[model samples]
Target: MTGKTVVITGASSGIGRQAATELADRGARIAVVGRHRARAEAVAAEVGGVAFIADFDRLDDVRTLADDLLFACDRIDVLANNAGGLVPTRTLTVDGHERTFQSNHLAPFLLTQLLLPRLIESGARVISTASVANRWARLRLDDLNWAQRPWLGGWGAYGTSKLETILFTEELARRTAGTGVSAYSFHPGFVATSFGHGSPLMALIALMSGGRYGISVEAGAVPLIELASTLDPGFPSGTYFDTLTGNGRRHRLAGDADLAAALWQRSAELVGCVPAR
Candidate 1:
């Protein structure tokens, strides 16, 4: 990782933080991105990397972040779309998208598209944080904001958003094929981290587990760290890793190429960007 440039969102805490620290230790130059200025700056300083702040809930912030990153890095070897969580209730962003869908899927989708040229030129790897809850998703691209569906305390929306993440990653791989820019999504497993803030069930699990639920934050981050490094074992691009391996259970809809393509187009339309063919 020596001399490589990696941009990690949500680097202020949890899996993103652990991954950033480990990558920096491996000699990669890190871009620590977070919603909190203090925490982001602290983590950046600790990891010997730069900090970029943006709230994914706002599209304007995402735009600014993209511009800042474009001006800051000459080459981006890795872009970690790891900033997001399950919202406990239905909420809309300033841009009029569902909170979870916007933060977890739309925001990263826009940022990645904006950075596409640089990423393609740098041959960067795009690694995203997803979850096994995607198996529970019954996504309707037309109802992405859940306006027509019952919110059901928002877990369903979160799952739908993750399903969107995996679809986006796969479609991204297909569009950018042979460009040397790989894309991947992974479930970090159930880890004890600050990521439980938005979901009640997750909060209960975290409290009960006392940081021993399934794995430590550091252990949960291994897949990301490993994939972002030059030492990566070379898993196929667009592979949705269950934890550390490419083989994992997924909803039948996840592999629907047409749906993935349609979702990509719809996402691009929603974010006001041209869809990649």
Candidate 2:
């Protein structure tokens, strides 16, 4: 991995941070991205790489980030779409979409589209940090903004966004077929992280997975590290891996070709992205 440039979002903390550190230790140059400049810069300095600050809640920030990365690196060997979380409350971004959905799905989707040309040129691996939470998701294409759904707090919104993420990976792989670039998504397991601090759901998670049963941040980063390093077996593009089992598995909706296609179209429409080619 020496001399390879890898772009990792959410690299300021948790699994993302751990993965960035490990990858840097292996001599891969890292681009640490975060919403806060101070934290991002700190991580970047530690890893001997560059820092990019971009808040996913704003589409403009995502655009600026893509431009900065394209300018900073001649080639990006790996692009890790690892920044995402469940908002404690149902909030909306400036773009008028639900906060969780925009941050977790739309922003990364748009950023990947904007960087597709370069990614293909470098034959980069696109790794999305999806989740096992997709099993509980109830996708509502018409109500993706969560405008009409019965509010069950923010879990539903987060889960649906994850489902969309897995589908996005599938469609991306299909679209980028024969381009030498690969797209993949994976569950990072229920790691002990500050992912949803101050939320009731997070409180429950801490209680359930704390101590002897909890998965460490480094443990949760294994699959990501493998995928980004391309160390795993010859897994097909668009495959989603279950980190819990350490093997490829079909997500609840990830197998439906029609659904994946529909999601790609809907997501591209939402993010104002026209897929390259």
Candidate 3:
């Protein structure tokens, strides 16, 4: 990764933070993006890179972040759309979208779309942090905001958002075909991070896994590091990686080609960007 420029969201902590450190050690220029200014700058200094602050809850912040990156880096070889959290309730963002759905999917979708041109030019890899919980998504394209069916604790909402991310990856890779850009998604293996706070679903997982509940933060970051650092992992663009499943396996419901296309167009409309197709 020497001489490569990598931009990682949610780098202030958890899997993203570990990847930023490891990638920086490998001689890449790190653009540490986080919601918190102090933590972002601290991580940037720790990695000898620059810090960018953007609240994923706001679309404007994401747009401004893209502009900042375009001006700060000559090329972006890797974009880790790893910034997200479990909202624990059916809440709304300032943008009037479901908080979990927006933060975990729409915001990153906007960021990726904004950077698509630069990524294609640099032959970059776009990596999204998805989850095994995607199986429980029960995704409804018409109910992306969960207004029709409510999951008050945010677990189901998180699942749907994750499913959306994988679908987004599929459409993204298809659109960027032959454009020298690749998109990958992966499950980070239930890392015991600051995420999922106050969610009963996560609590149940802890009980089910017993003593082996969650992996260490560093352990969870391995797959992300693999995809971001190199073009390896042996999976084609839009493929998803999960350690428990065969390589490139994703959720059963996450393979809808038509849905992926609809999602791309809908997301483009939501974020006010022209779909690259």
Candidate 4:
């Protein structure tokens, strides 16, 4: 990993933060991204890397962050779209999209699209963090913005967004099929982190799950690190992985290629980016 330039969003805490530290320790150049400038800078300082502050709540900030990151690095060897959380309330972003959906799905979708040229040029890999919760999601594609009927709670919204993440990864991999760059989504396992801090219900669930179900952040990051640095050029793309347990562990719904393709089309429309042919 020495000398490789890697960009990670949500690096201020959780699995992203742990991955940044581990990768930087291996001599990789890190770009730490977070909503809070101070926290982002602190992580950057700890890893001897650069800091980028941008709130995922706004679409314009997503574009600005992409541009700034491109300006900072000659090439991005790896991009971990790890900045995301579940908002229990039905809040609308400045762009008028539901907060949870926009943050967890659209933000990464747009960022990845904007950075595709650079990723292609540098032969970079893209890794997105999804969750096992995708299985329970009942996707309402017709009312994705939640204007027709508001989300009942935050957990449902979060699960829907994660399902979209898996779909996006599948379609993105198909589009980049023959290219050196690959796209993958994975469940980091349940980790003890601040991921649930935004919602009390989530925090309670995390607390109750306790240390047994929740692994260390470092342990959760193992698959991410492997996906980033693996030398296997022939590794499969568009696959969902779960901590070495193989395919069966993933939600059956997550593997629906038809739904995945539709979600990809919708995401491209939402982000205003043309999907790579």
Candidate 5:
């Protein structure tokens, strides 16, 4: 990984932070992105890397971050779309989309599309952080906004968005074939990170687990690092992994080629970006 440039979102803390530090120590040039500029700068300084600030809730922020990255780095070896969260309520962004949908799926979708050319030139690897919770997703492809259905907290919405994340990886890998860019999605296991801001249950779990039952941030980040660094022979693309166990599968919907294609088109339309050919 030496001399390679890696960009990781959500690097202010948790798995993102662990991955950023570890990658930097291995001599990869790191760009740490966070919602908070101060936190991002702190992490960047620690790793002797650069910092970028972008809020996933806003598409404009994602666009600006892409522009900044393109201007600063000529090549990106690894792009880890690791930033995501679960909103407790059904909130909407200025883009008029559900908050979880925009943050988890659309933001990274746009970022990857914007950087496609560069990723192709560098033969980059794209890694999206998915979770086992995707099994909870009951995809409403017809009503992605959830406006038609009554609010049921935000877990359903969050899971659905993650399902989209996996689908996006599948579509991306398919589209970028022979372009030297590959995509991967993986479940990081039950990580002891500060995720899920709106739910009391998440807070309780974080507190009670105290990093006991849950895996440490370092352990949780191994899968991401491996995917970014290695391209083993016959390694599958457009696939979801259980963890670092050398094999994993996604939910049934996530593996549907037709659905992945449709979601890719829908997502491109929603984000107002052309899907990479």
Candidate 6:
């Protein structure tokens, strides 16, 4: 992977940070992206790469980041849509969309869409960090933003966003079937990362587990690294993985084909982009 470029969002912390380090250690040119400029730069410095600062809450920022990344990197071999988090409160972004929905799903969707051409040209691979929370997702497709009920909590919203991640991966793989680029989403497992510290349930788990059950950030990043670097012919597309295993033990509604397609269409409409044929 020497000289190959890989762009990782949310690289300032958690699994994304570990993935960036591992990839860079393996000789891949890394583009570390984060909302905080200093933290992003720190991570990039550690990885011998460049830092990109972008606020995922703003679509314009995401667009500009994509353009800048393409301009800076001659070729992108991997794109990891890892910049996401759970918002404790139901807030609206500047785009008038739910914060969690926009940050965890829409922003990555837009970034991936805008960079698809460059990825195709470079024969790159796309990997997104989904979660086991997708199983708890009671997605109201008709009211995705909770604009009607408006009583949705943080955990539900986070789950819904992860469901969207899985769906987007499936549909993207279908759209780019014959193309060299392949997209896959996966659950990094229950790592003791700073992913859901704001939630009571997450806090409870952290308390109860006493840090035993929870895995390390390095372990959580293994599946993503494998998906990005592996040349295994048997690696399946439009599938969800858990810790590098292909077992369906943790499969959920996130892997539903029909829902994946619908989510793809909805995402395309949201981003104002046509799905690849």
**Which candidate number maximizes TM-score?**
1
Give lDDT tens digits, candidate 4, residues 149-217.
656667777878888888888888888888778888888888877776657766677668763457898
- The candidate, 3 or 4, that scores higher on lDDT is 3
Off by over 4 Å in 1: 206-212, 230-232, 275-277
Number of backbone-clashing residue pairs for each candidate, in the order shown:
0, 0, 0, 0, 1, 0
Instruction: Quantify all predictions' global Cα lDDT against the true fold.
Output: 0.90, 0.87, 0.87, 0.84, 0.87, 0.84
Q: How accurate locally is residue 236 in candidate 3, as Cα lDDT from 0 to 100? A: 79
- Estimate TM-scores for all models: 0.95, 0.94, 0.94, 0.92, 0.95, 0.92
**Model 2, 99-195: lDDT tens per residue?**
9899999999999999999999999899999988887798978888898877576888888888888889989899899998898899988887787
| TM-score, model 6 to reference | 0.92
lDDT of 3 by residue, 76-132 (tens): 999999999888878788998988889999999999988888998899999999988
Evaluate model 1: give its TM-score: 0.95
Residue 167, candidate 3: Cα error in Å is 0.4
Could you tell me how far off, in angstroms, the CA of residue 183 lies in candidate 1 after the best superposition?
Answer: 0.7
Model 1, 33-125: lDDT tens digits are 999999999999999999999999999999999999999999999999999997888889999988999999999999999999999999999
Which digits, one per residue and each the tens of the lDDT, describe model 5 over residues 13-100? Answer: 9999999999988899999999999999999999999999999989999999999999999999999999998888888999999888
lDDT of 6 by residue, 18-75 (tens): 9999999899989999999999999999999999999999989999998999799888
Off by over 4 Å in 3: 201-212, 244-249, 275-277
Which model, 5 or 6, shows the larger TM-score? 5
Model 1 RMSD, rounded to 1 decimal = 1.6
- Segments of candidate 2 deviating more than 4 angstroms: 207-213, 244-251, 275-277
Residue 127 in candidate 4, Cα distance off native in Å: 0.4
Give the better candidate number (2 or 6) by lDDT.
2
List candidate 6 stretches off by more than 4 Å.
Answer: 149-152, 209-213, 247-252, 274-277
